[model samples]
Target chain A: MTRDIWKHLILVIGAIIVLAPFYMMLSYSFKSPGEIDRGTGGFFGRQEMMVDERCVQLRDPNRDEIAAAAPQYPGKSDREIRDAIMEEAAVACAMRPVVFNYTKAFIEAPLLRYLLNGVIVTVSIFVIQVLVALPAAYALAKLKFWGREAVFGLVLFCLLIPVHAIALPLYIILAKVGLTNTYAALVVPWTISVFGIFLMRQFFMTVPDDLIDAARMDGMTEFAIVWRVMLPTAVPALLAFAIFSIVAHWNDYFWPRIVVTGSRDLFTPPLGLREFKGDADGSFFGPMMATATIIVTPLIVAFLVAQRRFIEGITLTGMK
Target chain B: MAVIDAPVAARTSREVNRQARTAWGLTTPALALMFLILLVPVVVAGVLSFTNYSLGNSSFDWVGFKNYDRLLSRSTYEKMFIATFTYVVVVVPVSVALGLGAALLVNSLGRIGDVYKTIYFLPVMATLLAMAIVWEFMLHPTIGVINQTLELSCGTFLEAIRFFGNGCADGFPLWLGDRDYAIWVLCFIGVWQGFGFNMVLYLAGLTGVHRELYHAAEMDGVKSAWERFRLVTWPALGPTTVFVVTISCIRAFQVFDTVEAFWPQGGGPNKSTYVMMFAIFEKGVQQNLIGIGSAITMLFLVFVMFLTLIQRWLVERKVHY
Candidate 1:
């Protein structure tokens, strides 16, 4: 009993240290700038209505605007009317810090567009990788053909080359073909996932040959068998692979950083967050943390919802 | 009967031929892409390492071995190698040890371990760049939570310690800014981000260890947990340890997100954290020094491949038991 208590104590301390930053990130995202700097707001931070300084400045009433509001405040002096309009603007712009941070996160940058780009890139890459790798993996695992050993050997050799290590040469290739700053640059190099092919091949080997033979007996062509027979049975493997691929490409900053330069339209979530950080001064921490939270939430939510599957998928790479 | 048998034999052979052709058809796209995307870049990097090749230049001079020599001789490159190796050496062993410790501790608890496991693994699931930025905030010198918390410990019994005493008198050390602490800070973050992953792997490996072995060890009078670990648990986790160490080493070598996030303009306060990947990005893409960059790339590949090969060799020879 004593030993168990000691273990729990130590583990709890470790958990606090591990979770501190996440706590800080979430807390900061909900606090106003004043609260964040003073570090005074506890957890969800006094959700007091706060005015956006930038919003107030942008809505500073010009002479014409004040004159236009003269009828509303009849018999009031010009200065008094101007002050009333300014006060109204402040009231209209007033919102909770959480709302401010999240709204600013979306409005200050094209975060939605960046996220869309993230989805497009990761989805396209996964779809294409499945298309390219499934057929090849099926052939390598099940089909008997000449040069099969050599092709499998090539796949194994390609496994060693981490795409990040070879980014320069890849960038050069993309540049030569005038493909940089385009979607193709982001998606092309990753289209051939040697790891995916290798993993699926290992999996395909476990599948019963009788099933495939039965498909062939039903007059299914080899192509039809790959899609119709092998794919359905490879669901668990493919789900694991999907999680692996989606998480990697979604969080990937290096490749996109290398390829998509000067194109905000093509920025992924990480790049967008990075750009936000680059120009952010002290007061922008709320919005910046909000951006970070938004970018990180999707995967974390997915993992929390499906903890077992996510763990299995992430550790799939390590098992080899 | 002989004529019928001949035609049947021919038709079966034709079927075999058709199967072979279809296999080729199935594999062609992947094979072509593997060559183009994976193999060709390696060849390109190797060839370009020997030339003064920039991206847009029409032609380049063949500066044979000059790029490699510069990498060997340059002070900056020396620092690059030093920083990269320091990170890998410090991070891999520490993270692996911590991971093993955490795994053992968690595995002992029946069901309560799941909570700790989930908490630890949160860092692994979070986006690293986002997490790195969060770390940057936490490490802020004056206003950050870390220093603020440290400051709160002043004039207490905790300040009786020498380091804490000094920090109490003077301000706490700037975690990211001080030259002496930058690389170590990076190492700390690397370990923090990575050990959970290793922990999960070790936990999985622990599950695979036979339960009866512990009963047998008890019968053999192995009373201590350490003795039990040595006898049964350690040997059972051999393959997992090899895998954890290799993966940790590779990841440690590729420590860029935190470094880049901390010091985007340069490596760190005195290039103290200028890792190889950053050097590659800096010189190769940023500066257009393709030759040197390619040389560094080749060197980086050699280190990784050698490490993986060593891992493979160890797994084959030692862990098969």
Candidate 2:
């Protein structure tokens, strides 16, 4: 009985630690400045407090200093307001509230556009990667050609080179080709991935040779065999890579940062979030957390929906 | 007779060449694309490292190792090297340990393990940039919830602590802004994001360990758990450990998004947190020194390749499969 109680206690503690920031982000997002001062509403402050009208205008002053100065609202003196704001900030930082800041953030930020770009890029990358990788995977898995292992080995070798190392070179090429500030800049350079090709090849190896032999016996073209047989059989592995690739590219900030210049249309969610921080009052804890909460939700939802397949993908792909 | 014979020979040679050209056609696109995207840049970086090519001006004058010379002369560059090494050494082992422990604990559940897995993997999917934004708020010293919580907990525990007083004045560590603790904070966030992935890998590795080995150990009366692990499971997990460690080290070296998001200027608080890639990024994207950035990137690429080769050699004896 004591062991069981202890086990439950430990689990509860672990869960609290895991959920605390999220809870704080949520609670603070709803809270007014006053409640955040009390540090009680967590992210969502008191229900009675009204949304500051300035948040909806989209023409608010730079938010970093002003938002940090926010605890003075509702008849508080400037000195007291500053102190209160600081104290409230300290408390919010501790609690990690989710509400008031996020509400303000939603009204003020360009979250929707950023999210749209992320979805487009992620989906397009996955679709194209599948099309290219599937054919290459089939050829590597079933073809009895000279230099096959050598080519496969070379593909694996390229995996060691970190993407950052290639970033500068790719940037130069894109600049020369005049693709910067365009969607082509974002999509073209990364169309061929060494890691994806290597992964697909590994997955294709697990398919029985007889399956391909049978398809060939039917006089199907190589492409038809790849489409009809290998592609369908590799669904689970593909799904796994898909989840990894989608989440990775969707959340990616660095590559997009390099590829994109001044065009706001091309800004992905991560970049948009950065712009929000720079533009918004940094201390509007409620809206900031709220924005963060909004930003994080789709990914969390995707993970939950595809949890089983995603887990298999991560585990298996890491295998030699 | 000689001209007729030459025509016959040439026709046969052209037909033979056509078969060779078909083989080349099948292979060209993949190889050409790879070369264009991957190889060309590498070669350019190698060449450009010897020149001084600044952005805003595309003048590429051969400077003959001046960039390398300048870097070697700088104390800051030396510190960056040391700091990056320390980060890799500290983060890789610690993350792997935490990952192994978490995986073991999560795996004890017979079914419905997906619940725990999803919860653990949540941080992995959260945008590091967005998370950094939230964390910046959370780590705020004044009026931040973290400091408030610290005051509440520590004030209750220690007599010296007072609420909103001088000694406990915003108990939150400066995190990324503080020189002493910034690297640790970066490492902590890194471990949190990475542990789930490692745990999943470890779990997979654990499952692949043959059941017969454990049964045989039990039959031989090897009662001690540590001995069983040392004699059987540890040996069984060798390949997984190697794979995990190699990938983890490579990932650690390439860590840019979080550090850049958090610090913006290559590990803030006096550049104490700056790693190799962060420095490369600052030069390329921020400073627009394409040549220097390319040089730095090539240097890092060579370093990673060398380290990977060394790791492969080191683990070759231990890896069973």
Candidate 3:
């Protein structure tokens, strides 16, 4: 019992340190600027009404507007009319800090567009990887062919080349082709996933030859056998690869930072968040955290919902 | 009988030829892409390292061995090697140890250990850039939770420690800003983001350890937990240790996101956190010094491949038992 208690104590301490930044991120996302600055407001942050300073500035009434509001103010001075308009604008802009932060997170930059680009890039890369790697993995695993060992050898050698390490030359390639600042730049380099091919080949090796023989007896060609026979059996492995590929490409900052330079339309989520941080002042913490939370929430939530699968997918690399 | 068998054999050989054609057709795209994207870039980086190959240059003279020489002799490159190796050397062992420790602790607990496992793995799932930003805020010298909490312990008994006492007398060290603490802080974040992954791998390894061996060890009077660990657990975990260490070394060598997130302009205060990846990005991509960058890339590849080869050899030779 004493040992259990000590273990729990130590584990709980580790958990708190691990969880601190996440807690701070979510808390600040819900917090008013004042609360963030003062480092107060508990977990959900009082959710107190806060004015949008930018909105107030945008709605600041001019001389013509004060004159126009003069009728409503009756005998009030111009300054009083301006003050009344300002108060009304502040009131109109008043909202809970949480709402304000999230709205700003979506609106301040094209976060939705960045997210769309992320989805497009990840989905395209995964799909093309499956398309390219499946047939090759199937060939490598099942088919007896010339130079098969050489091809598999090349695959193993390519595994050592971390894509990030070769970013400069790849960037130069894309630049020479005038493809930088384009989706092609983001999606092209990752299309050939040797890891995916390797993983699928490993999975496919376990698939019995009898299955392919049965399909061939049914008049299936080699291509038909690869898709109709091997693909269904490869679903679990494919799902794991999908998760792995999606997470890596979605959170990838370096390659996109290199190729998608200066174009908002081409920015991935990380790049967009970095751009946000570049211009953000002190008061932008709430919105910045809100953006971070937004960017991080999808994967975290997906992992939470499918905890076992996520772990299995991520640790699949260790199985090598 | 000879005529009939010969025709059938010829037809079967035709089928085999068709099968070979299909196989080559299937692999052609991947092979082409592997050549263009993966294999070609290394060759390009090699050639570019020998020339003054800026992107926009119409023509450039060959620079011979000057780039490699500069990388060897330059102080900036020296700092880059030091920082990169320091991070790798410190982070690999520490994270591997922590991972093994966490795995053992978690594995000992039956069901409740799942909760700690989940919590620890959260960092591995979170985006490193976003988390780095949050950590930056948490390590903020004034309003950060760390310093504020330290201030709370100033007059308390917790200040009996020497570093804490001195900090309380003056102020807490600026964790990210201080030159001495910056690389260490980066290493801390690296370990934090990484160990959970190693722990998961170790846990998977732990499951593969046969239970009857433990019983046998117990029968042999491997009495204490430490003894059992030394006799049973450590040896069983040898392959996991090898893998976790190698992967951690590679990942540590590629430490860029957090460093870049914290110090966007320079590596760190006085270039203290100037790592290889950042140096590559700054000089090659940003400053258009492609030669030095490619040189670094080649060196980076050599170090990583060497570490992986060592791992392969160690796994094949020693850990096979």
Model 3: lDDT of residue B25: 95
Those runs of model 1 whose alpha carbons end farther than 4 Å from true positions after fitting are: A74-77, B1-5, B318-321
TM-score of each: 0.98, 0.85, 0.98
What's the lDDT for candidate 2?
Answer: 0.72
lDDT of 3: 0.92
What does the lDDT read for residue A163 in candidate 3?
Answer: 87
* Model 3 lDDT tens row, A1-320: 99999999988999988998999999999999899888888899899898998999998988888888789988899998888888999999999999999999999999999999999999999999999999999999988888999999999899898889999889988999999999999999999999999999999999999989998999999999888889999999999889888988888888888888887988899999999999999899999999999999999999999999999988888977
**Chain B alone vs. reference chain B, TM-score for every model:** 0.96, 0.86, 0.97
Clash pairs (backbone) in predicted model 3: none
Per-residue lDDT tens digits for candidate 3, residues B1-321, read: 998899899999998888889999999999999999999999999999998889899887799999999999999889998999899989999889888888889999989999999989999998999999999988999988888888888888989999889999989999999999999999999999999999999999999999998999999988999999888988988888888888888889989999999999889987889999999899999999998889998998888888888988898786843
**Candidate 1 per-residue C-alpha lDDT over B131-193 given as tens digits, one digit per residue, 9 for 90 to 100:** 999999989998898999998889899899987999999899998999999999999999998
Which of candidates 2 and 3 is the stronger one according to TM-score? 3
Which stretches of candidate 3 lie above 4 Å from their native place?
Answer: B318-321
Local distance difference test, per candidate?
0.92, 0.72, 0.92
The backbone clash count of each candidate, in order, is: 0, 61, 0
Interface RMSD of 2: 2.9
RMSD of 2: 8.3
